[model samples]
Target: MTIAIVGGTGPEGSGLALRWARAGEIIIIGSRDAQRAADTAVKLAEKIGGKSSRVSGAENKAACAGAEVVVLTVPFEAQAETLKHIKPALRPGQILVDTTVPLAASVGGKPTRTLGVWQGSAAQQAAELVPEGVAVVAAFHNLAADLLQLDGPVDCDVIVCSDDKEAGKRVRDLARKIPGVRALDGGKLENARIVEQITAVLIGLNIRHKGHSGLRITGLPAEAYEK
Candidate 1:
């Protein structure tokens, strides 16, 4: 499937791209600047190997145009503008994956006031911005940039929550491409608030650990009770 990474130059974009590329999926990296977008494409082409065609780069709209699925990897600040640019290009059945974490860091690298998401959350905001046809899925919010930069087995799982079951499943399938990871369906779109709060806790963990820490959830998959 053709998946377009709308904010592909960012850390989240690169991480998702690397994982999906390793899974042999065609990835198109999109950026505000044509040059930067093309650069990411070139890098992926070299790593994944092809006629330099397996991966490609394009300016925002072009990258999103005709894509079966689209992911938003831009910063919280950029998400609005990027979506405005990409809204016109979205398809009927396309899914928009949001990996944005809204936190305003102070000069000292600590956040003073946590940024509550505009219009509920990055995912919900994206859904409202896009045409009603597009389905927005919140995922990969807590994944470390370092983990995505690696070439093999990602150790973290992404929590996916969406109002649309098929859209959620589409992203769930996308998450499966990365090794040592699983995508847990986080019920419905409203559950994104809980999922997003986890990022803040994880950030605190990273600070305490002094590294790009990862997170996983247990206590799932209950066994069926016998009659």
Candidate 2:
């Protein structure tokens, strides 16, 4: 499947594009600056170090045009504006995976603290802003971008939540494409409020422990992720 990472010049977005591209998925790195996005794609392709040509880049709206899935990895402050800019290109039946978190760092505060979003969470705000019929799935909140950039597997569990069951499942499947990562069914979209806040906690932990921390839910049977 072709996936577009909006704001793909950023660390989290570029890291995801790199991993997915390594997994043999078609990845489009989207940015406000088309040249910057293309540059990042070239860097990622070089990192893979092969004839791997599955990754490309474009302006945000253009990137979303033909993608089966659009992953938004912009900061919380830029989320609304970014979505509004790309709304025109989002077609019906497309899945939008929102990885934004309402971290207070966006507003000159500590990354360990979170801002209270009136829309309940960043993902909920995205669901409201996107054009209707585009399935919004909230995910990738707790994973550390530093770890994702490394060559080794990232030991992380992705909690995926959405109002649409199939869309959530599709995103969970996509999340698992990253090595050493597991995807969990995190229930309804409203639950994103809790999941997004976990990022702040994880950030705090990272600061206190001096390590890149991630989440893992134990005791879940393997069938929990089975179709």
Candidate 3:
């Protein structure tokens, strides 16, 4: 699939681009500054080495225009504005994967705390802003950017929530492309309120443990993901 990473200049965006690129998927890094996005894409391509022609870069709107899936990796403060800037390019039948977390850190507060989004969660807010018929799936809230950049497995579970069942499954399939990652069905988009908040708690745990910690759900059979 052609995946566009909006805000691709950021750590999270770049990290995901790197992983997906290595996985042999076509990756487009999108940024407000097209030149910066291009530069980051070049760096990622170089890192991947040998015929990494599948990765490229473009402006946010242009990136969203050509992509089958657009992944938003921006901070909460920039989510609405970024979506607004690229809204025109988002057409019907496109799946938008939102990785935003409304952390207090965006408002000069603690990173271990979350801000209350009037729309209930950042993903829901994204759903409200996008044009009609564009499906929004919330995921990657618990994955660490630093871990994604590393060479080996990330060892985490990505909780994917979307009202659109097919879109949710598509994202879950994409999430499994990363090593050591399991994707779970997190129900409706409204459930994102709970999933997004878990990031704050994970941040707190990371601070205390001095290591990046991730989530894992037990007791479910392997068939759970198949359904």
Candidate 4:
């Protein structure tokens, strides 16, 4: 199974690419520029203790063409533009993972405790735009890429929201490759808003704490999900 990551040059994309590369081969790092993408693939390979051949790079559309899954980690504002260019290329049954956070920039460089949600969360917007044939799964919102790049363990839990149960399960399995990371189903696509907003809270925590990173969710009853 080949996993292709769109906008993989960024931190979130880089971490995901590295994790998957360590566990499996045939990982593609997608970028707007083919050369940049190739460079990202090489760096990812090194991070995972692998050689270059196991990974490759491609332009955004080409990256999604035949891959089993494609993840988007482009910036919030750039999300729509990036997906607009690649929407036609997404294949049927391919899992489209969205990790974009919809929080807006703070004014006057003032770190205000506020959440700027788009009409809907980033995941919802992406899923709405993507063709129905593609299974859009929302996840990786609260994780700090710093935690993911370290070789030891993921040490975090990801809240996964998807309309497609099977696709959500695939993402869950993919999350397993990260040493300590666990993926929990957060129910249908509508729940994406809940998961995406946690980033705002995390940001608030970081601002108040001054430099602490990594947001993890824990503690739940025996029968309680989202633990």
Error of 1 at 107 (Å): 11
Q: How close is candidate 2 to the true structure, as a TM-score?
A: 0.98
lDDT of 3: 0.93
Off by over 4 Å in 2: none
User: What is the per-residue lDDT of model 3 for residues 132-208, given as tens digits with 9 covering 90 to 100?
Assistant: 99999999999999899889999899999999999999999998889889999999999999999999999999999
- Give stretches of model 4 more than 4 Å off: 106-119, 210-212, 219-227
- Which of 2 and 4 is the better model by lDDT? 2
lDDT of each: 0.79, 0.93, 0.93, 0.80
Error of 4 at 167 (Å): 0.7
- When 2 and 4 are scored with TM-score, the better candidate is 2
- Give per-model TM-scores: 0.91, 0.98, 0.98, 0.89
Error of 1 at 188 (Å): 1.0
Model 3's number of clashes is: 0
Report the candidate with higher lDDT, 1 versus 2: 2
Tell me which residue pairs clash in candidate 3: none
User: lDDT (0-100) at residue 94 of candidate 4?
Assistant: 87
Model 3, position 112: C-alpha lDDT score: 97
Total clashes for model 1: 0
Q: Predictions ranked by lDDT, top down?
A: 3, 2, 4, 1
